[model samples]
Target: MSDDEILMHEIDTQLPVADFSHSSPCSAANRVFVTLSGPNFRINNGFETDDMEKLYSGLSEKRSETKQNEFPLIYLIAPAETTFDQIRSAIRTAAKAGFADIFLVTKRTPASGNYLKHGLLLRLPTASGLSPPSIEPIFVRSDRDGSIFINTGPSQEALDHCREKRSLPKLNETLDNYAACARAGGFEPIAQIHIDSSATYQRAIDVMNAMQRCHIRHITFTDVTSTPHRTCQGMGKGKPGTPTQSPSAIPRPPQIVNPVKR
Candidate 1:
């Protein structure tokens, strides 16, 4: 099967069961992290025109609620060339709708395996050749044991859209509804990353460093985190420069306190 097909299948199998309802809601009272997956979908610049319009129009309504603290959406995709006007408009819509946070997923240094780093997620757009008008994106690393939760208000709305509910009249409206779900009854979102590759150790260290520099203050990897005994898509032998060792297989390199000679 094609990679997209596999990913779609996996997502289908992974999804939990739940009933749909306009009034009946889920939870969005807590903080969350959402990780997006699929075949580098984020980096692909030109989407079907219909899809792009549908996505943005949907985003507009969602943004309206974001200002009301009704729902929030976070992105997890590799950077790519994107139009500034479109991106800014989306952000504005999000702000107007009561949305708060928007995070990005960046490539691990030495790029290889399923390694991810948070805090540095924003840099990927630049790395990938796109820049938003003026927005800050939280970066998060995907390695070891990681999860992304999205329960703020529009949780149900997003879930419904993802499911492509037929009863919903307009695709654009779906975004706003989902934002409401996230804001109203937030649901937790998660995506685990564990792969055996030579560059794993270095990737982990880079992620940790980025986290520290960004002042994200609540990540841990000591006893609770370990390399899992499984493999994932796009996870095989790494490229050069990456130290060949799974995240848990080797010790992280020492951080340089000061490089310039006094």
Candidate 2:
């Protein structure tokens, strides 16, 4: 069976009986991580197109007088080239429905990690082609910053391996980096670096050492995608490199506090 099929089947078997059932209107009464998943949407040149109403309908739960607190965290997937505006729209719609937070998957980083304003979950996107050791600064930054997601590549081969579990080119560098950093401050990187890879928990562990990372209280190993994990398609992702921001506005890398004289 195809990886997607397996995922859908799992969702069918595991989707909670109450997940789709109507519930009394709730407020921030209960803390819960809600999953909002969407499939197809139009993305090109960093723009995403979808029906806002439909997106909301998928997330809404009926309310009753006895209101309970519920904190919903929406997760959305982005096709290549999905833009910022579309993401904004998604977030806007979800807020109308009272979502507590949003988690997103996109090829590029957002305009800025300004997610806290809207309670958006943050992911740390590492630079491609650079070794993990070379990017230690970013890792340190991510750890210090708190609540970051790290995805390495949209590797086609990685996706293929998820389908068959066939012997494939392992992302050795990414793997090694995760191992080295997993112990630092008790944070671990995910094995299935990319969401495009299957989200079966076993598949992830089979690929990389996520057991420790998963155990880290400060870290989260997000693998809900491909598990039919609910996400608002094109909810919100910032444009890459903050292109519109002025040079002065962009953050500079941390400088060595005590560099020896040249």
Please identify model 1 stretches exceeding 4 Å from their true place: 1-54, 61-71, 80-90, 107-117, 120-262
Best of the candidates, TM-score: 2
Which residue runs of candidate 2 sit more than 4 Å off their true CA positions? 1-52, 58-70, 73-177, 181-193, 197-262
Q: Write the per-residue lDDT of candidate 1 for residues 71-97, one digit (tens) a residue.
A: 343443332222222333332322222
Model 2: per-residue lDDT, tens digit, 55-167? Answer: 45544442111243433344444432333335435544544454534444332234535332322132221212322221221111011111113443352222123333422
- The 10-residue segment of model 1 with minimum total lDDT is 15-24
Cα displacement (angstroms), candidate 2, residue 48, comes to: 24
RMSD (Cα, Å) of candidate 2? 18.1
lDDT per model vs. reference: 0.26, 0.29
